[model samples]
Target: MTTAQRLPASLTPLDTALAAVLRDVAAVTPVELALTEALHCIAAEMAPLRAHPPQDLAVTDGWAMRANDLVGASSYAPLPLTAPPLWVEAGSTMPTGADCVVDAGAVDAAGPIAQVLAEAIPGQGVRRAGSDIAEGRTVMEAGRPVLPRDLLLARAAGLATLRVRRPRLRLINIPGGEATAAFIADAARLAGADVIRSDAPGRDAAAIAAALDASADLIVTIGGSGVGRIDAAVAALSARGEVIAHGIALQPGRTAALGRIGTTPVVALPGAPDHAFAVWWALVLPVLDRLLGRGRRRTQALPLARKIASTVGIAEVTLLARLQGSWRTLAIGDLSLDAITRADAVLIVPGTSEGFAAGTDVDAYILRE
Candidate 1:
């Protein structure tokens, strides 16, 4: 099972390769999905036709009255009412001309006339119209992932479904990389992709090429991307399409490759989990974002607990943990399962820069929401 070594002759810059991959790429057409099903999907603009609480509503279970009627009402000199005030429960619509609510203790109906024993202020126990959501205002913006809280607004808007762009991703597993492929597939699903996974019959070029000839917005091949004799993913992709960049300037994932099969963009990832994970963040996710029409991802700028030095001309992945309000370096270049599991954020060191100095402010993508 020993394969010969064949290193790359030249490494392509990360930015250059990324640009080439994104060239001519556009977001997928949007589709309507059930509100709950749209969670994590890239959302289209969500604006309500009308405001929630279309009319003023009572905020408490009590009698609804006009503020002016009880302005001078007090315990010693109770004000008499011509008629009993309308009763309203919490969340019920207020009666016409009624702008205040009072507890049962504040009103007495023992005599012929109802008495108000407490003063009231306008809007003291009322939820005004459009207070929860304004009409014609955007509740959810396009290109952002649908969150659970967003569903609250959707429900208020009386929306049964949401419009979203969910790209279809096909992951082809070259033999001997089932674990890595499974990991990538799960990650893609979490990113709101409709992931379809299949395995190549063998590790040969023909088997891999056959797997690459499927229809999808994006295709990813796991394993067999290196120049080793049996590593044939690059060759397989070349046979069916174009290999834009075979060797990228990325540490731990230098063997990763990018290409396209006709209109479908393809990425060849190494079998190693850490290597694949690095490329997933550094390369694959960007393409996924483009297809989803997503905007800038959430990131935080914080001072580093220590210096992170990197080799010039190669991009390196850094795993970080937020310790005492600062980023503590957990692992760099080669990542372990423990580090990956414990990571709170991720930082990518560009190939152009050597690294960041201690106490320097660095931007890192937040891993946990």
Candidate 2:
């Protein structure tokens, strides 16, 4: 689609814009990777190759013996073992004919003979094979992101490698808006993408087209989405592919644009750091999450410390701070970097609502950084 219009009335709703950007997006191809290198990657498939422990084993350092042989034994009258006691440590395999373990402290070993003062029970202090993880059990389902703690389970299951999906991203800086390129790239990397960055001066259409032609799964361009004279992202995008959205009904990010260059999705963000930051999470993050097979963001319901107002038709994105065990929207005249840096979470005011009263419960998306 060509640059048909650029008016505020033409802006799309946040939800509609997100749907358009992600309608055709899919997870990247999966590949085999070493278990150590699969952190934050999405698992294609995972299963245990072997059962943990692999056999019945002792759970404590004690003497292994038949439970029936130690019956009726007590501190008053101990039962003497006919043969040498079989010594076993924790995690050691249980010997044949051994069904229980007597604590070492409760047994007196006088040379070859041993005396047990307590009765032992069958299956006591023993861990059966497959108790922790059964062979061929599913460790993780396809499209689930791998976490650090998952590696421990995978290692115990005897998995040396895993199949994962890691999407590649291309970032472009338009003209004088090179300041936030690195920051955006870092955010993309944190979202589990390999990023390649380029700079296009004076709304260079050729540079933008060249970046799109790269073999990246997604392309992101900073700046050049506004109605200003220097704005050429819309033109460049139309010249090469389709512009799905030219604007969104969002504060500090109304100029954001979404489109596609062939099969690769392209996102155009505003130049300002705060605007780009807000828009990236609101719009770009969904695309990345879909391509990486990540789950939805976890949110917490918190009461507002103060009233927050917004325009009737535009969605306002606000930063939140935890104060006195309550969340308050960061009220700033201009959406600046300093304001965002002081916040701990993100609060969204939908376009249908004009404002929220103090003490109103709202869902806040936790910010890891």
Candidate 3:
């Protein structure tokens, strides 16, 4: 038998095995795109822009005045004005010879003459030019993810277009009897990668080989990657390509195959939904980061509400219940579709000692939105 003939109980962390396969994988080239299409994307550098108000405008409804005109004004004895004070409504332009605004409600008018009830301050109740944004200010920096609210700010800053880096990725996908492989393919990894699919059985070595040869920077195949009849994924890579390592020391994802077809690395994963997810998290994910030249994925540590034990030396990945906002162990043995449907995240326990305590903190990586 070959290396692919082994099982999950005989494997290491998917990350470790993948490191061996992706030997010499290089980063792809970057491209520039418009700001709108750059949302949720990575950029190589920051862009600078600024905004300035057109002219002084009224921010409130009041009477425009020379501030000194309101001196000693009071409700009982109002100040005498030369002519009727001009009305300046909110958002109106500053009136001629006006340097301040006294609220019209503060004083009433009698016989075409208005009285001031209190004193007014210079530049008061006025929206100054560039108040919302300063001149030559950096509105949207490079490398920042474009948010929905960015457009309005950008427009206010007087920018209609943005320059950003585009993510480039190449996918190598393996098909399963079910939609599980397609589920893995649909994932947006390391920013960008087009998923490629195949329909051959897991054991068809010849068919699997042709699929890998088509076109892809990375190779991923699903099903028959584990120990079973045919074992086409293993046979395809080991015979036609280079086999880096097979089998793992983890549970639920032990049958993972790490190898290379031509110079590109290939990750063969189990067909189960949860298992495929596990391999991608442990193995394929980091490779994506390395290829894309990005940082490792970080996660918040959430304490487990329940305890769990592993059956073997192989690392076991358990589905989580997320009780009371804390990640709790899921019923693994049940493995029911409904149970998986209700799961929030998958918890991985390293293979070695028997089990862990209920209050232990486990890093629960989120699976869905």
lDDT tens readout by residue for model 1, 250-363? 987999999998888999999999999999999999999999999999999999999999999999999999999899999999899899999999999999999999999999
Candidate 3 residue lDDT tens string, 1-369: 434355533456544665686679765454555566655554444455444566678889988888877778887887867687788889898886677878877767875766778888888988777777777666555444455566667667766565444333334344443577656766643244534555663346777776666356677777778766656677787876887877866566677778876777778788777677677767776666565555434455777687777765666667787677687776553355566678787666666556677787877766553
Worst 10 residues of 1 by lDDT: 1-10
Order by TM-score, highest first? 1, 2, 3
Ranking by lDDT: 1, 2, 3
For each candidate, what TM-score against the reference? 0.95, 0.86, 0.71
For candidate 2, lDDT tens digit of each residue in 240-288? 8998988888887888888998898888998888889878888888898
Return whichever of 1 and 3 wins on TM-score: 1
Q: Point to the candidate with the largest lDDT.
A: 1
Instruction: Give stretches of model 1 more than 4 Å off.
Output: 1-7
